[model samples]
Target: MTRKTILSAVGLVIASFAVLTALNYATAKRLYHSLTLFNESVIVENFSNMSDIFETVEIEKTAPEHKFGQAYQPLPKTYLYKGEKRDTENFLEKTSTTALVVIRNNDIMFENYYRGTTESDRRISWSTAKSFLSAIFGVAVAEGHIASLQDPVTQYVPELKGSGYDGVSIKNVLQMSSGVRFDEDYGRFNSDINRFGRTMALGGSFDDFAASLEKEREQGEYLHYVSIDTHVLGMVLRNATGREIADYFNEKLWSQIGAEDSALYIVDSYNEPMVLGGLNLRTRDYARFGKLFLDNGQWNGKQIIPAKWVTESTTPDAPHLKPGKRDSSDINLGYGYQWWIPENADQEFMAIGIYDQYIYVNQKAGVVIVKNSANINFMDNGFESATETVEVFRSIVATL
Candidate 1:
């Protein structure tokens, strides 16, 4: 072929590929809830959409931000996931991982960034923010702002009156057992949770959406993962403490936890923080929170979280919330206040989010691993399930 003819052929191939990519995006976007940033073409178009979905509450760092000590340690040559040995690069690629930070002995042992992310990027926490809200509850309880766990949530947030949360206790909401019927299907366009996302995307009131949910079962009857339960917790905190969630978070947790940077929380039309999720922070700052939990809420000679609250929040004290008792098929796990417990755990728990975000805490091993990803198919394959992700963290901690 002549030079010009060959060049023309290559251009034609490129144009065809671009057309195919656009077609894929159009189809996937029709099922918009499932169209994630993991798709290369979609991500290129919609990656910035996260910040646009909601207004943000800035958690300012008070003077003297706690800095993490650098004592870098190399990762293990290989770690096992699903009975197969894998290297670090393979694991990151498979999970669509963005950042991984391992903290051992109060130091950064291993930290890696991927997909153009840096150490300073304030990656969205997704549902992992639930754990942060749970921690904030500890502070509220300690300060006497929240009188008791058994107190009815309606006592504080009377706005939930006549709704599913009418008679639910604060603890019920914390444990995801308020028994509200919410479809948390991430793949379904019409799921209730995705509808909430759509509402937030357009500056709708989260309080109104939460209060609109009808009751399905008796409160505290059985364990069900209704995320809006966490929003109720925020309402209780807001009423009981007479403060915004962002200010409380900064005063109670962020300022003293040795966080190197301020974090951001997505807000609603009423300026209510999205406590159910929508917390964004640096990976190292996330590890700081994990380390605080591992140390029983102590950081730098200060008890940031009450030690007793730490114990109660990490253990599945409620009968139905037991790891093995609640559900079988895939979620062979228990839940605490807002934390997830692995089966047969030894003082270990995790804060997980959809799309593969994690903060795995192993108290026995003195390890806290934080992972951030944009995984679109996290729920599809058995290997990519949350259970298998725990196995990966365990293997890494074991090698350390």
Candidate 2:
């Protein structure tokens, strides 16, 4: 080859190398942002903007929306915390709360947004999405799509057979007692939950991640807070009904309930809804769900979810699932199918998510309170953030 031709070939190779390097840099930057999305500095923005950072499937909003009535009220000035009263507003600020909505008698009593968020922002639901899934699962059961809760989960999702989920009853999985040995400590970089987050960031299969777990104990013997158990329910729902979770959810729950806006679920590489904790919606919509359960699955005189299933899901049947501390259980709060019965309860329960998200319902008081937070200190002091938030809700209810 001539000298000029050789130089031209070298230039072409140099250009190709530069383009490859730039692409790699861009990928690395994206991966870093995904991994650090929850950092204290950016968590507030990140929580409300999850769709921009991850793959999401939209749950379309339905027409003739069920809107809330306005009866605006002020929150209580003080709330009890560890037997000491603290300023309620200060507490909210301390916890990094982004949005709060209080509803009673199907009306919005108080609503506020913080940290540059608004009513339109679709806040991440985190694990609270499990409760939403539980509602839809009830629909499947009522429609006879699922034969029985006593049946093994593998009967629906045969892919889970030979894995940790094999032979585990659908009921046990619903109750979060699947006996799967999976570490959910988000503070640990190498914990299973963090690994799962990484998998989402890198486009891995959530189904495969769940199937790779190992059984730690016998099913239904104890109460274990396994996040993956919810995902298994999603799988069972999909297989039993032969439909995608998002589509089914829209048809049965989202559309039927009259959502104000389209919500989203962060999906995996295969477009599977991360039902364990990937739902996103406005704070008011969360309260709407809480209201649905508060009214025993009725919305505007229509039976959206089976009333019997609501009763069954919120009531802990087994001793291991009862509140106020137990050797067999991992938490002091009582466990139902996918709901939480707080200690010293007076017909109250809640759906909780990581980083301080809560949809608390008080039946006796006819109250529903939704709180969304970006609390980086959520795990500090043995989760006092969550325990205290319960007290805060109670105080507000008393005032209402």
What value does the lDDT take at residue 385 in candidate 1? 63
Clash pairs, model 1 backbone: 323-333, 323-334
What shift in Å separates residue 249 of candidate 2 from its native position after superposition? 0.3
For residue 352, give model 2's deviation from the true position in Å.
Answer: 0.2
lDDT of 2 by residue, 204-301 (tens): 79999989999999999888788999999999999999998998998888887777999999999899999999999989889888999999999889
Using alpha carbons, what is the TM-score of model 2? 0.94
The residue-level lDDT of candidate 1 at 271 comes to 88
Please give each candidate's TM-score: 0.87, 0.94
Q: What RMSD value applies to candidate 2?
A: 2.7
* Best-matching candidate per TM-score: 2
Error of model 1, residue 340, in angstroms: 0.7
